[model samples]
Target: MRISPAYLKSGILVSTAGVFGSAFLWLLSFKAMAFWMGPEGVGLFSQLRQMAQAATVGATFGGTNSVVQGLAERKDEATRRQFRATAARLVCLSGFAVVLVIAAAAPLLTQFFLASSAPALVATVRWIALAVLLNVGGTYALAVLNGYRSYPYLALAQIAGPAALVMLLGGAGWWHLPPDPQLLSGAFVLCFGVTCLVGAFGVSRLPKLERALRLGALPKAQSRAFVRFAFSNLVAALSTTVALLLVRSWVIEAKGLAFAGLFDAGWTLTFNYTTLFLTACSAIYLPRLTAAVRPEDRRACMLKTAYLVLGAGILVCHAMVLLKEPLIHLLYSSQFQASGEVLMVLVIAVIFRGVSWVYGTLILATRNSRILVVSDVALNLMLLASTRYALDSFGSLQALSWAFVLPNFLYLVFVVEYACLQNRLMCRRDIWPFLLAGTSPLFYLALSGPQWANSGLVTGLSMVVGLGAAGAALLAYKKVVS
Candidate 1:
């Protein structure tokens, strides 16, 4: 069951393209919405969308992992098909049940969150809730597709959904449609639906992949096992969501939606691109990691994946810090320029995040569900606790960056220690050099302007520093592959 390097490479290419391309479209949509809706609108959109994502996590629980586990183990077409069908039904049903819970609590949620009635915003929240089923359902299916190793099919759905979304949003804009939260959410819902539909088609056809759907039940024991695993996933999802809502509430209360928008934007810039790599890495590695029996194999798998992620991450963050302002203006707007500074500070967290994800995956590979849940919950709390303190103490937007950086570093320590103790793994990180290289650009660019009006000495030093980081990252990547 060892994954071939070629297999991993192919998945990496397709998955990277799909995720990155979709991310680009989403970024475009965010920019357009910012222009049409303003910071308040974008903030509302961000909140509602987060709610949808959080709810999806809860509803599906760890059903996705179960699906992946079931499908990955089942080489028999009939058996895998039946498992897929059964899991699909369970996920949709669970998603619907969760949506009902959200619907009932919607009023309370909006009131508590917004701190005002805000009818239109509440309506938007309700509208976005409808997307939960589609979102979770698609995720379940995608994981199944992923388990089947059908990268092309997964890529198709992944790309088409965003492609369709960009088109939908483009049409809406071309019509000079008055942008409201609902209209914008409708576009998002469309993306979810497209992904679900395409994934359904893709999953239904996988065999080497052409197995027809098996709407019939899987074995009773299998069904029970799926439920049990999914329960752990559900707890993990709920805990993370609670922490997110807590931090988000603090941000909105402390600085208004505008600052929240800046926070979200900066975060997206710093984190999202690496997520593309993480997604590809997980798809290629998870199955192989699960199949690995020896602790040596697991450690090698963990370190190799972590190294790859760190190398990719350092380069990406460095480029982001170097080009923050223009990219912000280009991707978003000048109103979002505050995001550039926030982006610089937050780039530091990418190191911890990338390395931590690798460590966390080791826990996941073992199916040590309790430890995984505990680590996730701990990370979420650490983030919320620190961000709350930062927001409360430092009245400036810059505080949010520290909020991200500090909590992530602490979480990295927790995960690293936990992974080592649990799996006898080592956390060999190469960070300081990358960090030095990544921040060099910001030092020269200055708070006054990114304009080249800075001292000549500082500018040369910054370029040298930035180039050195990029070079180190590239060398690290080469070292890993070699």
Candidate 2:
């Protein structure tokens, strides 16, 4: 099916706005929090969030994403509504239970993460935990909207939480209150509560969802299939989280919380900016891929999405790598400026991850959580191993960054092989565009120092080249399509 101009434009604009808006607000909150709280507090804030999110992913039982995949292919509106509502109901029950567990564990986890648990830290953990529970409905709402291909509403709900949180933080800043982790956590919870309310309202307004409230019992077979898929996905999600928590633990043990904060800061910057493209891809591609049942159709969609995102990622990463130091300094204090080398290396990861998301979405759309688990577990193990060696030997985060790059390369190789062989998708003509786009930033970075990259003349030249290459990749993709 050809993408209509208005539909495509609306999708891009709204989805981009959604991602860009949320990123902006979150980034802004980071800046404000940093200024309000010192680096250590920021570190605590970030750590709490990571832990809370991991827990939420587990507690979700993978219902959020499975809702999308389950509903995507359902041509029956009533059935889709049932699936959506069922997931929402089940996740809410799980969320409440998870909140209780997190609340109980807050004291211990706080001490574990921070080396000493104070009342404030424990309180902060509780607040973030509550936020996670509070936001479950919103999470499922976005998933439902996505399943329906309601990009605009999905985008709206995506930003609603962050936007609300930003306003709260901004108001706090206006009042000149000191930004403690607990206070920031409260803002997170409160704003997210609002976000959940907004999402529920939005979903309530949808046509058939109201009918879901009227339905009594779901089809046993359908419910069984969705729950099974969601459970498998939950394992994958939780496993990745465990791996990440291990990595964070290692970083803190080796370097301390201050450095952990810096590491997270660097990592966060890379993903936040780069994920903008990935977000757009998900909004546009997942439903499309989900609706395509034929193997050829799925493969074709995967390659096209991969090439498009990878091509776009090249230009973005180039600009980001070139501007890394300045961008970090602009967003954060001088304390964060140490991560330039790491960010430079992470540029490659960004490009790789940009494409990986396409492949990942394809895998997810096909409901192959087993592949997702194996690939992810392997990469995480490699990451944990290499990162351990790098930290032990070189004692440098930059070395650790390269360690991540190694596993990710292997991960992408495995992913590409799987996507090609399993789906029988062949796009030899499209491969070069991704390779060229993915490699150009790395080539430039390896040859020049960060100072050279950041210089006015070099930055300008690189931007020009990047824009040209990205534009050409898009043109080439268009040609392939025709």
Candidate 3:
């Protein structure tokens, strides 16, 4: 059952291209939206998007992990069909329930997000709720695809959905549509609808992916287990969403709405690119981990994947940090110039988060729900406390960068240590190379306060170091596979 190096390499390349393609399109759509709406509008859109994402989590009732597990573990075709049928029924029912709840609470959502309950805004919230339903179905489809290791179809759905979204938004602008919440929300609906359709089509094309929907008897025990695992995922996800919401609100109250936009800008640049690597790696990595039975086998897979991610992440982090200002201008606009300062600090956090993500995948594969939930809660609480401390001490939006750095670094440490102890892996010794590569970017930034980004000597040295680390990582990965 060992995964082949050729398969892993090709799978990662295709997955990365697919993720990058979709991310690029989404970024373009955001850029267009930012140009039209400015910082405040961008911040509003971020918040609304966050709300829909949160609702999508609820709508799925946390079944994605369960679905993946059920589909991945079962050897019997009949059992797989029964599991798929039960999951589909649950997903549909839960999606309907969440939509109803959101429809009922539209006014409340408007007040919470917009600070006003105008008729138009409330209607916009309802529209976003419908988008959540589409997204929930899409999420289920993706989990099923993941269970089957259908990475090409996964990539197709990922790329095509966002491609449709970019086109829709581009067309709206060409038609000179108003840059309002309603229009933005409608674009979301279209995006999710297309993704859902593509995912469903992907499932249809794979005869092995077919579910026996007519199978009358539901597997209640398996359904409950899936739900229980999903609830754990839901709690972790909701904590993150709530923390971001609170952080944005506090930034608005302390500085202004525009300041919150700056926070969003920095946050986006730091995490979005990192997520691309993580998601692409997870596409192949998670299934392998799930199928791996021995501790040594799991450790080998985890180490190789971590090296691969860190190698790629180190290069990306340094490049973004060095080019933050110009990238901000190019990706966002001149109005977001100040966001570059925050981006510099946040990229450091990105390295830590990227390293931690490898270990987090281990946790997910092992299904240690308590550890997952507790660690997630701790991360968010630390985020809130650290950001509040930064605001109290520095009293500037730039200080919020500390909030991202400290929490992720600590979370990285926690996960690495726990992963070693829980699995009896050689993490302490083996982690040093990644730790050195991960922390190397912090020195210049800490000393010069983003001024180093402008220094040619610093940039050249960083590029050299980043390339060397990446090259070594790739060699190490090849060694592991061989």
Task: Give per-model TM-scores.
Answer: 0.88, 0.91, 0.92
What does candidate 3's lDDT look like per residue over 1-482, in tens digits?
A: 24477876776777778888888887887676677777887787777777877787777755356677667777666677787877788778889998999899999877776666789889999999889999998888887876776778778888887788778777766677776778878888988898889988888776563344445434678677766777787788778777877777677667766887877888887786677557666677777788778888888888888787778777877778767778889989999998877777787788888878888877778877888789999999999999889887886656788678889989988888987986885467676675676557555664474456677788778778878877787777777741
CA RMSD of all predictions: 3.5, 2.8, 2.5
How accurate locally, in lDDT, is each candidate? Answer: 0.71, 0.73, 0.78
Q: TM-score of the candidate numbered 1?
A: 0.88
Error of 2 at 195 (Å): 1.6
Whose lDDT is higher: candidate 2's or candidate 3's? 3
Looking at model 3, residue 269 earns an lDDT score of 78
lDDT string, candidate 1, 1-482, tens digits: 45578977888788777777777777776776666666776676677667777788777775356566667666677787677667778777888888888777777888766554677767766777777777886788789878888888887877777777778766776677776767766776888889989998997785453446435778899888767666766777678667767776777877888888888888777765556557666666777777767777777676667656666665666566666778888877888887876786777777778877777776666667787777777777778877878887886667767777777777777777877786654543544455445555654453445456235565556656656766676566556422
lDDT (C-alpha) at residue 152 in model 3? 80
Ranking by TM-score: 3, 2, 1
Which ranges of candidate 3 are over 4 A from the true structure? 1-10, 174-176, 208-218, 392-395
